[model samples]
Target: MQLRFTTDNADAAVLDVEVKELVIAGWVGRDRAAVLHHIRELEALGVPAPGAVPLFYRVATNQLSQQIRLEVVGEETSGEAEPFVFFHRGEYWVSLISDHTDRHLETFSVALSKQACIKPVAGHAWRLSEVKAHWDRLELRAWIKTNGDWITYQQGALSALLTPMDLLNRYFTDRQVEEGFAMSCGTLSAIGGIRPSSEFGMALHDPLLNRTLEHTYITGSLPVIA
Candidate 1:
């Protein structure tokens, strides 16, 4: 899907984003508490500040429905060791905190000058959408990594990566997904004309995809926000 950002002036920007494919440890076999404890334990061992915790956002074709926190506190070097958690926690997802400041020198900007949200659609399987209505009938699915790879389940979703301008442009431009709503998992779009939240952007954050990108990397790729 695409990365969108909303500005204070009620505008939006579309930024280039990416998601990384990783299988988290202990995803297939862990309860909710265990998962949380795992993060705590990692914190005890020191994995990183924000690195251990990933904020998740629910994405759709056009709107962001809700959000959750995916705490990543386990070991980053662990493999398949039952007790050893995976690198990709199924319960954990991440999104960038938006500031809307200028930091890039190359990229386009769109104005999402309206109030909107992000959502995904469901037909034969699951697909990301830009319309809020599409999410009305769809159920959330999660593919936590209790052990092996990401196990898709009917629980929740994970977010791809995004940047500050990315969040603004989406809200400013009012872009939408074009194709591949069936075979593919999700797509990206931009919207506009609405101000972002004080700290974050929307009311919720989470998603369903296999890619992620750092905010700095994404910002650099853009044409520089002003």
Candidate 2:
């Protein structure tokens, strides 16, 4: 048996993300306004709006199209820090797991320092090129049967390689994503200190990957590293 995979666009892979939690620092008298202002801006941009608490955003991505989308999903307030929680895109279906552990969800929170950290339950980061390569190796083909006419896309394949964080109009479920809004306060809370705890963020979703973290967060995905 031979399987065929497509490699039409290795440079246009997007990663989908669900917002479990977002941790941010600098909680003061003025932060309330800043948070509200930020929420308003996000809502204006089409992100799902949150209530009067911390903020959260949902994300999704497409590899071939190279687009990502983010929407606000959940919110909560820690005594010290605010945690914005969100749901995953593929949250409804059972996730494809490597270890058969049945881990279906991944969570991320922005620390008070302003760095985003992903929880361990999150899946691995997928690369467009890598997925394309896997598909191509499979040699899979799709056939369309028409009356006296036939059309086929030579180098196109959809892969289940990338894991999804947030899905839309699908199912509903919830999970704990953050340790706390503010693990630590004071000068120790710098934006630099806020980092994604999951490998998906640190290694795959690096800040310099495309100069569009905000875009990725909203859209749920980005292109492969070309």
**lDDT by residue for model 2 over 46-150, one digit each (tens)?**
444443342223221111111122211122111111111222332221111100001111112222112222212112223332332332122112122224342
Candidate 1: residue 77 lDDT (0-100): 12
Cand. 2 TM to true fold: 0.19
Tens digit of per-residue lDDT, candidate 1, span 4-65: 32212222222222222211111121143554654465445432212222222222333311
Q: Per-prediction TM-score, please? A: 0.18, 0.19
lDDT score of residue 210 within candidate 2: 32
After the best TM-score superposition of candidate 1, give how far the Cα of residue 112 lies from its true spot, in angstroms.
31
